[model samples]
Target: MKKIKNKKIKLGISIGDLNGIGGEIALRTFEDERMLDFCTPIFFASAKTISFLLKHFDIDIKFQGIKTAAEALEGKVNIVNIFDDKAQIDFGVETKESGKYAIQSLKSAVKSLKMGEIDVLVTAPINKSNIQDDDFKFPGHTDYLNQELEGDSLMFMITESLKIGLLTDHVPVKDVAEKITVDLINKKYKTIYNTLLKDFGVEKPKIAFLGINPHVGDGGVIGQEDKEILIPTLEKIREKGDLAYGPYAADSFFGSGNYKNFDAIIAAYHDQGLIPFKTLSFGKGVNFTAGLDKIRTSPDHGTAFEIAGKGVADHNSFKEAVYTAISIFKKRKEFKKLTKDVLQKQKRRPASSRRGRFE
Candidate 1:
């Protein structure tokens, strides 16, 4: 990690579907001048499009137009003119043009992130359906980033109090069981454990896994997946000195308040985790792509076409996404420093002094 001292982190922003609430929320988030004190924001969109949105939404704020992310200045909201042409802004509809522009913005911001021009990335909501073409064939941002980034990507939904991860994301419900093999479970669990340690600064984290069947197979009377697959895998994980527990029934896990007991919860499928997470922390939660080399986060909510240009969209989640990305970036830097210091100290110690007896 690059050492950053006495300087604000550069935050890269991708303007999602222009027809959706992406532009509105991005503008609303930086409307407060105090946000500039934390990090410099660079929006990957043209100044003309932003100006049109600003006028349409009736917001009064000044922003600098820069030709590149490297030209971003601290204490000012910057716009990287990814395109020079004027965009057609359809407030409450998705179009091919909107999709194309959204992809352009995302690719530009990601490129800057890969080149280390930006310290972190907080993306706005994109209409997943329209943002697909020949070049981009993934279901969503997590899938695309999994290929572009170094480490495995886990869709980790986080709030100040609650955190939930999915064992299988963007997979059909019928295929989820097949996807949750021993290797997949081990990989996702290790990713979550490491994310808790390095990203969230949690030490000795305890993770709970939700079951695949109702009542955890009701002692093998309901289904065999929980009894056959999840149970044995979790047992093996625990044997390896990891605090892994449960194939608990997913239906009542959140209702019974058992989720509060663990550091993080891993759900069997997408809806199994996100339903409760959104119910509990809607408009406040952040979707963090955990176990990735680069820091990326986004608002938990998607593009609200109904409320696109109404100026009524809530910016809390987007703001929290920014804050979370910055927080994780700082935490990773600190963790790397601490681990490096520990390794240095161990290397300096003599072999005779390092030997210890269990007795």
Candidate 2:
């Protein structure tokens, strides 16, 4: 595959559930003219829908409408008209129509991302219940992207101060214990380890794993999964020279400020990690889907149906998601360049000289 140049990364924006606050937060984010300097945003939604939103919110911003992602212009909010017909604006109601339009926007944006028309994607919030159909059977965006994209997906929730990765996201609490197998641990650990190096530029990442049970199964008195499953797996991981630590008590891990000591934390399930992460960085965190060949991010919070179209939804998280995607995209390019140069140098070296150096 050909590499896209780093200058003015094409950021694809998917307008999530129409009835939700997806449109509002997206528009609010790009209203600042300075954001155009970092990337050219392409909103995969109809021009009519965007116009309705602008008028409803009483926000003054002009956008250039286009039929395809190729026609996107720099320094202007560009909308790729995915549909010509107007979508009904129900404010806070969850209808089948809203779900249908949400998936349409998402599908269009993902297509552009796969074709290399967009360098990265920053998705708005989607209602998981509403946006389900024959085409999209996955629980959430990460699952769908995992199938569409190249590598194993890790749902990484990040902020400047804290970073958390889920071992099993979108899985029920009852099923989380069974999903924490040796293979799953190794796959997730490797993904996060490499992501830290290539995506976040961490030289040697220190990762902590939160326990599935309370107080890490209370030293096997409470449960044996941590003692039997997690302990053995972590020991094997350590033997391989990875900086993996802990089946630490999830309850006290964050309150004790131990999270600051590590590069990232891997939680056994969804709520175990997100609960603490949102508590700490609620409106500022970015949900980054790591370990994939393509880059995708979303706001930490979900579609606020209660606050939808109220003009009071906070756009900071969505804004941070865009910034995070851009930063990671640039970092990945730099990593590829550095690695490519090293490979070329190694290829030029004599075999006898390389053997002597290893000796």
Candidate 3:
């Protein structure tokens, strides 16, 4: 990880579908002056689109248009125009033009992130179906980002009291069983474990693994994957010194309030994890992409096409996503400092010495 010298971090944002609630919530989050105290905001979108939304919503905030992210000023909302073409916004409608520009905004933000021009990336919701083409063929943001960073990314849904990670993201239920292999389990577990330790400041996190089938396949009566796959893989993980337990049945795990006992929980598929998470923390959950080289976060909800331009969409989840990204960024920096101290101390020791100490 590279050291950041500036106390005020720069937040890079991607405008999702222009027709959706992405632009609305982003403007709402930065409306408060208190937000400027934590980070400088730079949005990757067209100034014209923002102005159109401001007038449509009757919002009265002035935005500074900049040609590059480097020119962002303190306490000002800087908009980096990625596209020059004009696309009309049809409220509560889906169009190919919106998807095209959404991809452009995201691509620009990703390039800036790789160049170290931004500290963290906050993506708005995009229509998965409309955003697909030859170059973009992923199921969702997590898949696209993982490929871009060349890192194993986990879709971790976060709230004030809960954190849930998915083993199979944006996959069909019919194919979830075949994808839950030993190698897949090992890779996801390692990613989640390392992220918990380094990103979330958990020294030794206790994680729970929810079973795939109901009643854990009832010991092969319903299915045999749990007995053949999960039980044995969990044993191997435990042997490697990670605090992991469960093949717990999904129904009773959250229904009985047992999720509060662990630091994080992992599910077998997308809906298996997200359905419960959204139900419990609908308007306040933040989707944090863990295991990437740089920090990225988004609201747990998706593009609200039906409610677009209604001026009734909630900004609470998007606001929470910003707060979570800042918190994780600070935590990771602290972790790096602690590791650097240990390395420095070791370098000063005698050459003949053979000693080690655990923190």
**Against the true structure, whose TM-score is highest?**
1
lDDT of 2 at 139: 91
Model 2, 252-312: lDDT tens digits are: 8999999999999999999999999999999999999998999999999888999998999
The Cα error of candidate 3 at residue 196, in Å, is 1.1
| Residue-pair clashes, model 1 | 0
Compare candidates 1 and 3 on TM-score and give the better one: 1
Residue pairs that clash (backbone atoms under 3 angstroms), model 3:
none
lDDT of model 3, residue 146: 88
Clashing pairs in 1: none
Q: List the candidates ranked by TM-score, beginning with the highest.
A: 1, 2, 3
lDDT of 3: 0.89
| Worst ten in a row by lDDT for model 3 | 350-359
Candidate 2 segments whose C-alpha is farther than 4 A from its true place: 1-6, 348-359
